[model samples]
Structure formats: C-alpha cells, structure tokens
Target: MDSATHQSLLNAARQVFEAKGFTRTTIADITREAGIGRATFYVYFASKEEVFAAPAHQVRDQLVAAQ
Candidate 1:
C-alpha cells in the first residue's frame, strides 16, 4: 500500500516494456524485474494493460511538462 512499492512496480514495468515491447512483456517478466510476487503485482494492478497505462500517462505527462 505504500507509494514506494507502487512506484517500484511502475519502474520495473517500464524497463521491461521498453526492452520487450508490450506484446512480448509478461506478468512474470514484470514481477521478476520488480522483485515482487505475482500477488503483489495484482494487489496494485488488475492487469498488465492497467499497469501499462500509468507509465504511458507518465510519459505523456512528462512531455507536457517539458513543453
């Protein structure tokens, strides 16, 4: 429930997503990179797409902020 753990997941997901692209990335891959359990991932996110949206929006937000 802490932001640290939530952000950890996001950071890990971003790394894996950038490396593998969305189609090739899996829940196991993200959890492994995040150093967390699958249940832990589910506790924060309902699905991979749900997790993906956050980072995607983050990227968008950064772009908007920079302009």
Candidate 2:
C-alpha cells in the first residue's frame, strides 16, 4: 500500500484501539474507520496487536525525544 493509505490505516487503528482497546477492537473496526477493506488492513499489519504496537511505540519515541 502507499504511504497515504498506510498512514490512514494507522490513524484509524489508533482511534479504534484507543476507544475500544486492543482486544476488543477487530479488523472490521479498523477498516470501517479507515474506509478501507479488511484485506487492506492486513496488507499493512499482521494483526490488531501489531497495529497497537506501532502507535504506542511512536508515542513513546516522541515522549522520549521531548525529554
């Protein structure tokens, strides 16, 4: 997928994961919020757990950099 699409998925995943938490948020939730398909979500991330990690790590990196 392209960078724009990937970032959209990541942003949508972050929203859903934050609201619903990792275990409760499904592929459907991410894709629906992203306005993409299930296959599209899988193209970028292997699973919900993987999706959760990226944003959390990004936040951590930003926080550390600010310190």
Candidate 3:
C-alpha cells in the first residue's frame, strides 16, 4: 500500500481509538472509518497498538530532527 493509504489508516485508527478506547476498538472499526478493507490495514500495520504508536513515533522523529 502507498503512504497515503497508510496515513489514512493511521488517521482512522486514531479517531476510533480516541472514541472507543483501545480495549473497545477493533480492526473493523478502523477499516470502516478509513473506508478500506480489513486486509488493507494489515498491509500497513500488524495491530492496533502498532498503528497507534505510528503518529507518536512521527512526532518524536520530527522533534529529534529539530534538535
């Protein structure tokens, strides 16, 4: 999958995770929000936890670059 698609998944996951919390959120919830297939999510992320960390990692990397 492309970076745009991967980003979409992460965005969708962030929304769902915020709304439903980690325990309640499922892959289907994220996929539905992203308008993508469940399989597509797997192409970008191994699990919700990994996806959740992606944005944090991005920010951390940016901060490190700035420093």
User: What C-alpha lDDT do the candidate models reach, one value each?
Assistant: 0.95, 0.90, 0.90
**Residue 54 displacement in candidate 2 (angstroms):** 0.7
Q: Give the clashing residue pairs of candidate 1, or none.
A: none
For each candidate in turn, the TM-score is 0.90, 0.90, 0.79
Best by lDDT: 1
RMSD of each: 1.3, 1.4, 2.0
lDDT of 3 by residue, 7-61 (tens): 8998998899899998999999999999999998888899888988888898899
lDDT per residue as tens, model 1, 1-67? 4588899999999999999999999999999999999999999999999999998997899999999
The reply for model 3, stretches above 4 Å from the true place, is 59-67
Total backbone collisions for each predicted model? 0, 0, 0
Q: In angstroms, how far off is 45's CA in candidate 2?
A: 0.8
Q: Pick the winner on TM-score between candidates 1 and 3.
A: 1
Q: Which runs in model 1 stand beyond 4 Å of their true positions?
A: none
Worst 10 residues of 3 by lDDT: 1-10
What TM-score would candidate 1 get against the native?
Answer: 0.90
lDDT (0-100) at residue 24 of candidate 1?
100
